[model samples]
Target: MAGRRALKAVLIDLSGTLHIEDTAVPGAQDALNRLRQASVAVKFVTNTTKESKQNLLERLQHLNFNLHEKEIFTSLSAARSLLEQKQLRPLLLVEDSALEDFNGIDTLEPNSVVVGLAPDHFNYQTLNRAFRLILDGAPLIAIHKARYYKQKDGLALGPGPFVTGLEYATDCKATVVGKPEKSFFTQALTDVGCSPSEAVMIGDDARDDVGGAQNAGMLGILVKTGKYREGDENKINPPPHLTCDSFPDAVEHILQNLL
Candidate 1:
């Protein structure tokens, strides 16, 4: 900590660190408020492809989080940017709710396959169609290959396995555009005008959030809530700067120590 840059921003993970499903982590809202009051820039980052940004915003608001749409960034946003950059018509295998994020993209004659966490769209017919397209030279775009996420019921499958299946069968590697990707962290940090060394990432996923940010040159805090399992801090090389029990604890560390 001797030579670290002064903290100027915080990139927070959405689902596990702040909330799980419809329930906000205990005192998370207040914790966020405290951070805001400190005058540091704050941004929300997530790989949730289950719903559109608008829908996700509504859910967060319903849970009493005070945030704006522009302050939130999702993996869907990154995938859309990639789609536009490549100018490829994608066969989006994402949830109907998430399709709203890709509304303007051409999907009629798909030249690419974009996969997310869409249980309803993971059927044999849909996958077969995507498989055929990939076989025909369509690029496979994976929004994020997360293994599992925490829900009210417990851990559930994420889109990683499905994306890997497509990759294995098609013999084509997927272009991932989400967490743990340096580009994703850079995009979020750029928007807030903060350098990675001057920011911190607080999240529950050890690999995607903490390790990812650390890889991008920021400090990371691993919280025990959300999808965190036992000994997750040890799963990654160069463990988190700190591990807290919840969002509030992370915030406390930031406010007391980092500031």
Candidate 2:
């Protein structure tokens, strides 16, 4: 394949791409500052569904990340949009604060359902109830399809399996609202007023970021900082347009090549 072309906008992962364990990676902030100075459009895309949009913005601000809420896109936001478009309220199988910003009605009606990450609230009983609701014709929606997320300690089960189990028991398909889905990428591009070909996605996860971008008709760049390991490049079904050591390096490459 040809090398990834220049981009009018850059979509970046938040956690490992910008900061690790609350610490901003070396040159990460500088790179973002440079992008701003050069007037390069940028968006932060994250799969984290544990926090509300306001809370996420506040947290990132507390971490000294100079970003606006509009430039951030989360799986939770996607899921919320999906439910609202359907005019269906969900039982909300998520954290108490997850539905705080959502506009949908909350009810136990047969048309209502659940969506979100499952950690503390995930138990056999919760799964059973979710299953029952799905069997009753309630739709299941997943924020992101990630099976696990990297933690400081180790890998832990994420929202994917819980959603999968419910799908299995209820025999209902779930609408995934996160990356690798065209809706999420298209929405982000639309927010910036850029075409799919005018944007580039950079992240540590090849499948979620790189592969997703490629599938969305955007350029994809992979960074070997977070979950990506050595020898994983060969495994990418469609190789990324470019690969770098970290977010800073990736930003530098964008500056050098695109600007």
Candidate 3:
């Protein structure tokens, strides 16, 4: 890598890289422990909007991963920050479980539309409601436009298609506040007090996790797990700094070379 700097922090993708659903990736827990022993600042950055941060932490703990809630930065947090910054009450089309993160936000007479992966809310009536709202000048905010994500049973559709449908209907581009977005990476890096050059991002999605981090000036490592398919690395221009077999493999690389 041309701009290699001393590794100060490691930003990891939670769902796919470390675990998929309730099942932990092989050796991932031990691998994280290795990183912990090495004294590297580790932060979990996720675009998961299915559940609140508290719930997510609980799931991680259930999977035997030890981490603090504050160490986890999420796109939901970013979307909420944006909503607060603009003072726009939003009609949230996210999962009910994810609503806890936006608890304090005003949702009355929503002046904007915030969307994530909400299968229950993606029905015709609800989508039409959001459609009418956007057609009436309400801004659309997408937490992330991932095409699909890994589930215990193969892959499932993400909110990208829904977001695109809204965009097409309203002819208004939605403001994205998740992975592959430079602002999200900037915010995550800021929390760890690390510059982009001093951080590495490990994830399974080549486009969002790897490509996005690389675009934001961090070394991106694509893991061959989660929603990863063969030849995914080639899909991105300037492929990942390293494409490893799994989370543990990525950690070994960090300990052996990057450190």
Candidates' C-alpha lDDT: 0.93, 0.78, 0.95
Q: Which ten residues in a row have the lowest lDDT in candidate 1?
A: 148-157
lDDT of 3 at 81: 96
TM-score leaderboard ranking: 3, 1, 2
Clashing pairs in 3: none
Q: What is the lDDT of candidate 3?
A: 0.95
Residue range 18-101, candidate 1, lDDT tens digits: 888888999999999999999689999999998888998899999999999999899999999999999999999999899999
lDDT of 2 at 64: 78
What TM-score does each of the candidates earn?
0.98, 0.92, 0.98
The CA root-mean-square deviation of candidate 3, after full C-alpha superposition on the true structure, stands at 0.9
- Higher-lDDT candidate among 2 and 3? 3
The candidate maximizing lDDT is: 3
Whole-model lDDT for model 2 versus the true structure?
0.78
Candidate 1 clashing pairs, residues 3+ apart or interchain: none
Query: Where in model 1 is the C-alpha error above 4 Å?
Result: none
